[model samples]
Target: MTERIVVVGAALLDGGRLLAARRSAPPELAGRWELPGGKVEKGEAPEAALVRELREELGVEAETVERVPGEWPLRSPYILQVWTARLRPGSPAARPLQDHDALRWLTPDDIWDVDWLDQDVPAVRETLTRFPTETR
Candidate 1:
């Protein structure tokens, strides 16, 4: 089976907290936490997809700082392209859209508490370690 390419963004907020969204659709994986992003459309750049997905899923605009360099293939058949981003100026309220049910800000240790899609768990774990929380 061909792998699906999905784009996800790692958004950090005040106090070094990361943003995670809950999946609300596709019965099988409903309620699972994941990074905010969606499938990359045909011929679309992953970075562009990340920006679009954030705007569509969360009511905020973001710019990609860099691609989280690595691939985590999930058992669910998705090969995710993860990117790191910082929220844009202005406080925008985020409402669930598409397959998401809710959103939360989490620290590294708190990340594992949420139910995540099988393939996403590894990425989350790796990211938490790679991007340790910075004291501000």
Candidate 2:
């Protein structure tokens, strides 16, 4: 059996808004919305991996505020976990310069409107709950 790969997703919150990225590739996942993150490299700590992935994928320095609390199954041999994050002090706002084609900063009331990846919905919902009601 193939070893399962742990992929971390970031629910990057700035103020009361949550950042959602629109995927652009890997035919199956194309055009869907997701929390931005990448696979954890061998021997890399998950938090460190998450920060690195945010920099690579979003072009900003992020710090993990907390883990969002659960894991979800992706394709076979992959699992998705999410974290709460914020841009590091002095870091610019994130841009969609990588695997994503677009970006949206969703307020709490409208966060549900995006077409999120099915496997990520639960974690996304949990991430949404992390925000204050005024934002959500």
Candidate 3:
């Protein structure tokens, strides 16, 4: 059986930019940039897992707008579910929790500058394609 792993993440458009996180430790590719979410717990639904992760990682509430419609395999052997979400009215300020060192709001061109987890790269690329940066 393929060991299944689910990553719950958000594509928050803050001021028309997407949010990303810099990871800290333990998880092998620590210093790389990643979407602000985590592994889905056993028996938890992926959408619910995303909401929980956003609240835990970023101190915000999110509502799923859509699932990105594909899976990307990680080097560590888990397939990722990239979900798109919208911020809810009562969302709290984002604060680093768990293994994230910092957070950033990035435009499409600037996204490639941050080191991303291998699996997430495709999803991020797909997202950028869908929501291109407005050229100034």
Q: Candidate 1 has what TM-score?
A: 0.83
lDDT of each: 0.74, 0.91, 0.78
Q: Give per-residue CA lDDT, model 1, range 10-123, as digits (tens).
A: 544435677888988889888888888877888888888888888888877887876666887755656776777877778486678778888888876677788877777766
Worst window of 10 by summed lDDT in candidate 1: 127-136
> Model 3, 26-108: lDDT tens per residue?
67878998887778999999889888988887788888777887887765656777877778887876778777888888876
Model 2's TM-score against the true structure: 0.95
Clashing pairs in 1: none
Q: What is the TM-score of each candidate against the true structure?
A: 0.83, 0.95, 0.87
User: Could you say which candidate leads in TM-score?
Assistant: 2
Candidate rank order under TM-score: 2, 3, 1
Candidate 2 C-alpha lDDT tens digits along 17-110: 9899999998888899999999999999889999999998888998999999889999889999899999999997788888899999998878
Model 2 has an lDDT value of 0.91
Worst 10 residues of 3 by lDDT: 127-136
lDDT of 1: 0.74
Off by over 4 Å in 2: none
